[model samples]
Target: MTRIASCQCGQLSLTVEGEPALVSACNCTRCQKRSGSAFALSSRWNSNQVRDRSGKGLTYSRKGASGGNVLFEFCPVCGSTVSTSLELLPDVIGIPVGCFADPAFPAPKVAAWCESKLEWVRFPDGLLLLRDQTQPMDTR
Candidate 1:
């Protein structure tokens, strides 16, 4: 199966094949700010999975809680996040799940940085929850 994730303005997009390697949620402060939400849901895919990218994206780089730089790509027109690259995982591209705008999109398998999670935040049962970023999400 193929999926397409695009920005609000439709200016930038990513077309990928098959399923994602992993889907996760992060409650870190940076994620909260970047996503403008309680947490950020992201799907990790191999760079090769991205078959097409439409339009140019504005790039922003910031140091993550993990101490590695995270590069964000957003639509220049609508300012919606399109995708991200982590220095810690060079070959993996992280796309915000919301960009897909699919209610059927897979749920996050793991929740990280729970120490920074809000009091009312909760995830489904069987979902791995990490108190901090100490553990890697792809351990399986």
Candidate 2:
């Protein structure tokens, strides 16, 4: 199967093939600001799975919870983050689940940075909740 994730204005997009390696949610302050929500849901895919990427995007680099630099690419026109890459996981690409806008998209199997999660936030049963981002991303 293949999936396409696009920015709000559809100016930036990525075409990915096959299923993602993992799906997770993060409640770090950076994620909250990035998604404008209580937390951010993202899917991890092997860089090779990205068949195509289109449109121009601005890039931002930040220190992630794991103490590695994470580069984010966002649509300049819509100001929506399209994708991200972590220095610690060079061969992986991260895409926000919301970009797909699919109601049937897979739910996050892990929730990280629970220490920063909002007081009222709750995850579904069976979701592995971690207080920090030190755990391996592929621990599913």
Candidate 3:
């Protein structure tokens, strides 16, 4: 299946083909701050899987919990984070689940950085919770 995800202002767009390798919700402080929510939900895809992308979004890089840089791409007009790429996970692009605005989109299977997860936050049953991301994105 093909899916299209875009920023709030429709300036940035990502066209993803086929299914994602993994979907996750991260509760790291950076994720919370960037998403302005309890967590950030992302769907990972191989770089090649994303095609027909359009936009001139700005990128911001920050040191991640794994000590590697995570680059976030946001729409300059709306300041909405549309996608991310991690130095630790080369050739993989992570798309913000919310950008799709599809209620039927695949749900997150894992929750990472649970140590920083809000006390009031609750995860769905069968969701794997990790105190921190210990494995590579492809492994999970």
Q: Name the candidate that leads on lDDT.
A: 1
lDDT tens digits, residue span 1-140, model 2:
98999999998999999988999999999999989999999999999999999999999999987889999999999999989999999999999999999898888888999888899997887888887875533334
Which residue pairs does candidate 3 place in steric collision?
A: none
> What overall lDDT goes with each candidate model?
0.92, 0.91, 0.91
TM-score to native of every candidate shown: 0.94, 0.94, 0.94
For residues 46-124, what per-residue lDDT tens digits would candidate 1 score against the true structure?
9999999989999999998888999999998999999999999999999999999999999898899987888899788
Per-residue CA lDDT of model 3 for 97-118, tens digit only, reads 9999999999989999888889
What is the lDDT for 122 in model 3? 88
Q: For each candidate, C-alpha RMSD in Å?
A: 3.2, 3.2, 3.7
Quality of model 3 by C-alpha lDDT: 0.91
The TM-score that candidate 1 achieves is 0.94
Stretches of candidate 1 off by over 4 Å are: 136-140
Return the TM-score for candidate 3, rounded to 2 decimals: 0.94
